[model samples]
Target chain A: MKTWTIKLIVGGCFILALVVTVTSFFCNDDFWKVNAAQALTLILTICIAFWATQLKNDVRKKKEHAEQILKKIQAIVNNDGFYYVSAESDAIETQKRMTMTFRSLNNSIDLLKKYGQELGFKVNAEYIEKEFKDYRDFVSEHITDVDYLSRSESTLRKHSENIDNKCDIIIWGLY
Target chain B: MIVINISKDFTDTPGARYKSEGEYSGELFRETILIPKYVEAIASKSQLKVELDGGYGYATSFLEESFGGLAREYDIQEVLRTLVFESNDEPGLINEITEYIKMARRERK
Candidate 1:
């Protein structure tokens, strides 16, 4: 469980203990009061001194992992290689360039995904790298067929625009 | 049984492994074409025969993701029962794919 969740649960338990203690005192139940107080003290001490401390340490580790992931993600954001799409006159060549471009982005995004998986975070932007395969396939099929090349190029261009949008979303979401 | 040619119906970019578009990469091939055809074959009670010919050499990762992931998604028995790969002159391509499927099944266990 999250450290904060554990803390909240422990806090609730302590409040319940206090309410029980007050009720027992008003009822003049000295034996029950003493037992409840001792039990609460022991339980609180164990939870606070051991479990809470361990949970805090776990939280600290996760924080460090997040910081590390953010650092790597930021470093990846500065990589401007995927920012420019080739403007080559050849539709086939241009599409080939885009495939390679997404491959590069995929590698970057995949690395971050690996780290995110390890740290138990969601990295849902991998489609920026992987989902372009369908368009690439369409482009590749029409590479030699100039008659269909226009349609392929147009579709690829549209998909490229969508990919660029996802790229921005991925960059912003690294945190 | 329905046999689909990888190099013909798909792209003939041979010797490709990982992330080439079309039938060249295993993952893309599986996601785009393989699974769709497989599902169709299963629904129709037909065995899907996949021709691995005309494409580039296979990569272990691609094979793993395609067949292995398939095993992970569906049952290994179902995949084995529903699918067949043409030797495509590649002596051990089917074996390699089967190994991956087996590995994935073991992982599930």
Candidate 2:
């Protein structure tokens, strides 16, 4: 449940408990019965408030964990760090740069899937994996073309942005 | 298993397809290192395990030319059966090389 929703519930319970306690004092003719009713409502309110606090703490911890994982993914998908694969670029260096980053991204996606599944987050792991692989394959096939290289770089930037958006959805979905 | 560590046996920085392209070219590797070891494995009836780690990284052209050229020289199935890959650093390269090997045979036919 969302923090706001939990806050609302706690607020409502507090108000209800206050009203019950105040009314019981007014109904002095049935003193014992009113006291019993007031005690029950107060206990119930306290229980609900404690439960909400626990839930809110758990959500906060999970969000922090998700952010850490997303940061690692972002670093792997650092599009700006990619080597421009062109005629001038050394073939050995280009291959090294592409393969290392691509493999690291694959590993990150695997980690994301494992944690996302464990945490009940709906991660589009397959889509992310496909996007990374497609970009690598396109680079491999069109290494010498400046135009194609430019396009791949743009696509890579977009892919990185897409990953950010996806992570945002997962974080927001927690609410 | 007859092992061939490319990084150990040949250059760690393997380059493009043909020897004319540059040093440590896939063609050079196939001729100098891969083919001779493959021949020995065949004679001994053992698997040639090509360890594709400890290297900088491989170009698609390098992988395709080396393994695909091997498939071209030998029966495709025989090459596939005789050669096993150990590429823990980049496991995906194994599949990529396998596809290139298969495609090279198809192109030959």
Candidate 3:
């Protein structure tokens, strides 16, 4: 439940307890009024206790979800994410890898948007997007450089690593 | 608008950057599919919309070569103005293509 909703529940209970206690004092016998006030206080205390537990659970779940997204971003940075595949000779395999990578990156952006906005953090997607574009461009530019493939591959790997660092900066800011 | 559905008109399984790389290459797309439609659109004074969804995925080379190569042949500004790209599957693709077109000449030089 939303923080506001929980707060509203607490507020409503407080109002109810105050009205009941005040009315009992004025309208009931001293012994009955005292017992009624005590009972109402106990009920209010239990409600608050439940509300606190629920709030803690909500915070924990949000943290875990953030961590899950962080792990995915880490995988992309490590160049070993499920979608991050080596460029293969087979066009079909290559296409599959590329498609998945694109989708994965896009999904990361979406996840960051949701979590960051909810958590009141700034999300800058430009850096990651540019880094990915650079990596892809490097691969395409040097795909046929057979004589210097190793050097080009290293440069490509560096670009991928750069993406990882950028993610840390952007996504870590959320925390 | 003149619409070119890449997945339908051309091979959905697009390959690498150059023709020498293999079948369904970016060079092939540019020379065969993209350029012809572009020319027709130009002649008709209509904007060409290149739909880039429904494909497995595109290599950077394929994307760069196809759109960037077009910019190389025509004025980059004209190419940018005349062509519109739609990639619902990958929203970033439009920006990537735009960058490729913008940098085509510098890279070529």
Candidate 4:
């Protein structure tokens, strides 16, 4: 339940307890009436306490899940930077690795989008999806282009810029 | 019809390990040789034929990344209509390639 609703319930219960005490003091002071009022107050307090505890546990779980997803997003960024730098070197082996990296990068970005959507980051998910599609189209086009190995460096950089732009929002908004 | 022999023109050994079929290992073959050659043939409106028997063997990855990738970029039926198979040495190779193209289309859908 909302914080306001919780406060309202607890406050209302305290007021009822105070009213019962004042009425008993002013009236015939029936012992049973006082006892009934006390019992009702105690039950409401206990129920409120239980609800608050469950809410705390849920918040803690969400925090942990958010932390885990942030760590994964960081790893993806690190790999993107590594691949971008690796692609720029004038080496055949490195060049070959760049294509493989692009494919792997695609899968990572896709997963990030999925996790974001599940976390209710609808806007962020859309951004990731649009950028991912662009990356896929670029790869499909060049996966057959001449000198693709050497030419892919700039493309990798393009992906780096595109993906990094949204990482901030994911980190900031989800938490 | 215009034909390019995979073993003769592109590479004698064509395939990716089944274990890492997603290698994109043979990407070079597809991008640099196979696609350009195939596109050149298709642009001329000439029926393009791929001679598949000369290669050491075919990998599902290589075939899919090439023909399957092509089907994604071009019209599947048009691509298939313009293409033929010269797999006399291995009659099944043509069917496998066709299957890859069909499957790739389904995957995209």
* Number of the top-ranking candidate, with lDDT as the measure: 2
Stretches of candidate 4 above 4 Å error?
A: A1-48, A78-111, A140-147, B1-109
Model 2: what TM-score? Answer: 0.61
Per-residue lDDT of model 4, residues B22-61, tens digit only: 3334566667776786788778988888887654454445
Fraction of native Cα contacts reproduced by each candidate: 0.00, 0.18, 0.51, 0.00
For model 1, the docking class works out as: incorrect
Docking class of 2: incorrect
What lDDT tens digits, residue by residue, belong to model 3 across residues B1-109?
9999999998777777888877788899999989999999999999999998897767778888899999989889889999998988877779879999999879765
Task: Write down the DockQ of candidate 2.
Answer: 0.21
Least well predicted 10-residue stretch by lDDT in candidate 4 chain A: A140-149
lDDT: the better of candidates 3 and 4: 3
* Candidate 2 structure quality by residue, lDDT tens digits, B13-68: 77667876667778899999999999999999999999998987766677887999
| DockQ of model 3, rounded to 2 decimals | 0.35
Clash number by candidate, in order? 5, 0, 0, 1
Sliding window of 10 residues with minimal summed lDDT for model 1 chain A: A77-86
Candidate 4 per-residue C-alpha lDDT over A1-175 given as tens digits, one digit per residue, 9 for 90 to 100: 6989999999999999999878877886464554767999989999999999998888667656655654554566457443244334543344344344434444455555566666677677567657655654454343323355345667655655666667666667755
Best by TM-score: 3
Clashing pairs in 3: none
User: After TM-score superposition, what is the CA distance of residue B72 in candidate 2 from its true location, in Å?
Assistant: 3.6
Per-prediction RMSD in angstroms?
A: 13.4, 7.2, 7.9, 12.8
